[model samples]
Target: MSLSPMTSVVVAASLAIASGAADAADYRNNPFTLTYDGAITQNLPGRVNIHPVTYKLNGLDISANVYTPPNYDPKKTYAAIVIAHPNGGVKEQTAGLYAQRLAEQGYITLAADAAYQGASGGLPRYVDKPSNRVEDIHGMADYISSYAGVDKARLGLLGICGGGGYSLKAAQTDKRFKAVATLSMFNSGRVRRNGFMDSQLSSVQARLQQASEARAQEAAGGKVLYANDVVLTDEQIAKLPFEMYRQGFEYYGKTHMHPNASAKYTLSSLLDLMSFDATNQIELINQPLLMIAGSKADSLYMSEDAFSKATGTKDKELFKIDGATHIETYWLPKYVNTAVAKLTQFYARTL
Candidate 1:
């Protein structure tokens, strides 16, 4: 007997889930499930603590981790930062690392899995629309602002990779984010519309047609289609042309792999992503801005472009980490330290 295509997809999805559960079991003893270096293994009294939390966002449960500074006192006020993870990334990866580091700097930091992408709640998982991503940031701000000891007026936002793009868009009108920052910003809309480095410029229309069809199929209750669903071999990953993507595989798929982290998204998401622009109406953001990128990153253009267009803020600055590639800033001690230091200063001054 032969399996139908839908059966094959369902079986594959089941296997992926089982594999993820097995991988996650390795960290079952560790409550936080954090995979970053120097992560807190236990929440000790009188020290920075990781608090697992869940809140409602658009009728879905949003899972997040709140890192509170050492000796945190709810009676006293403190600034807060909402850290948004990269596309396909969960709160347990680099986002958690940054949130922990910022917590160590005496600020409360919250990192949540994007709804539908990580451990958060949503139907038809891996839907990656820009509007949804932007709302994730706003929802974070809303939740963290009410957190004990957080000063609602001093809230800040930090977005990494694709999260950076959504953060920019979120801060454009949210206004509650007094300061906005991005690390190795990736404009999902731009890449989705024109392809990486505009390599697929000729196929924009073709891709749109496919996305339209995918949406139609979903509306008709057809089996959902996914993009970037297959895992790649190491050889294939190494052959990837862009350094950002090449090292991204090592970071996301190997060394820093997490059960919730993935690369797949609903194919119909392109219908929304293709027309979305992170920098559109960017001038509406009057808050302080800081954009950081690796000097050698191929994705540096995205940060630079957004920085230049952020004309609404006179206090904006673009900082580059010398010699660091896009993914290197995520985990490399030296680069991460430098980026965190600059971020600490920027938040101290602006938040």
Candidate 2:
């Protein structure tokens, strides 16, 4: 039964529409679905278990996954770690993977969705306000301290990508986090203001111009549009200046794509990011700090720059994973293992 090309196109379009509707319904009801590729179940020993938990923080119901260590006793308090996800990422992404792995290593780990994103609550979804995001970290620490089986005094923090920057900001004021670590930490403010590697310094005025237009549109009752770096086709992806952008899509857009994950962010809120600087208060942090970044990453300079600006002495360490790119450290075994090992040692020593 050979159909005409137009007929084939119509059939394909119909199927896509139906599939999209079904997905939308599922998302509206459940918000998230865990795709068990047996990565965790098969690899983790039978003793460890990951539990999905929800708690309220700052008038919002926050969703997170908590991994309990094997042979856990309620009477015995255990050290805990709070894992924050990358920008445009939910808890179930790399954060969840790291949390599960750390739980297998005998530490209780909690991976949380940032406010206004993923399963967490906020109005005008996907707003990436720096202060609110930093508060989310502190909120997670509060949740950890309230747990009966968790020791509040031995709390540690781990953040990936933008979350890494937020973790550093949180640790500045929240001394409850005895140790802090970041994986491929991104200084969102620096990149927003000066661009990655400072290559877009001259384009700052242009970006501000675009943002002003976006604001004008919003004022005129227009829905805000988002500009995402995700490239769908080879031609579109070829336009990326570096290989890391293409690699990031592989990790976040394809292999581990979540229905709740969004590629775009509100254009108007971008101005907030440009003005937000997390590194300004690094001098206030007195806890042990670990900053992990890939030497080959285009974003590596941000982490290095932050580490240099941090006034914390004696306990701060910067580890560069040789030959790895920024996005490669997200889920790659070699990079993930290196990060887990470094983080485990850092927390073990400090907490």
Best by TM-score: 1
Q: What is the C-alpha lDDT profile of model 2 across 1-351, one tens digit per residue?
A: 232211111111000011112221132333335422323442244576777788988888898888888887768899999998887788877788788778877788899888888888887677777888899999889887877589998998998888999898999989899989999898777766665566566667777667678778988998875545223464544455566666655555455667677655666666788788779878888888899999898788878888998887568999998888988787777887888887778887888
The worst-scoring run of ten residues by lDDT in candidate 1 lies at 9-18
Q: Find the number of clashing residue pairs for candidate 1.
A: 0
In model 2, what are the clashing residue pairs, if there are any? none
TM-score of every candidate: 0.92, 0.86
Q: What local lDDT does model 1 show for residue 153?
A: 97
> Lowest-scoring 10 consecutive residues by lDDT in candidate 2?
9-18
Instruction: State how far residue 36 of model 1 sits from its true place (Å).
Output: 0.4
Off by over 4 Å in 1: 1-29
Model 2 / residue 14 / CA error / Å: 31
Candidate models: Cα lDDT each? 0.84, 0.73
TM-score of 1: 0.92
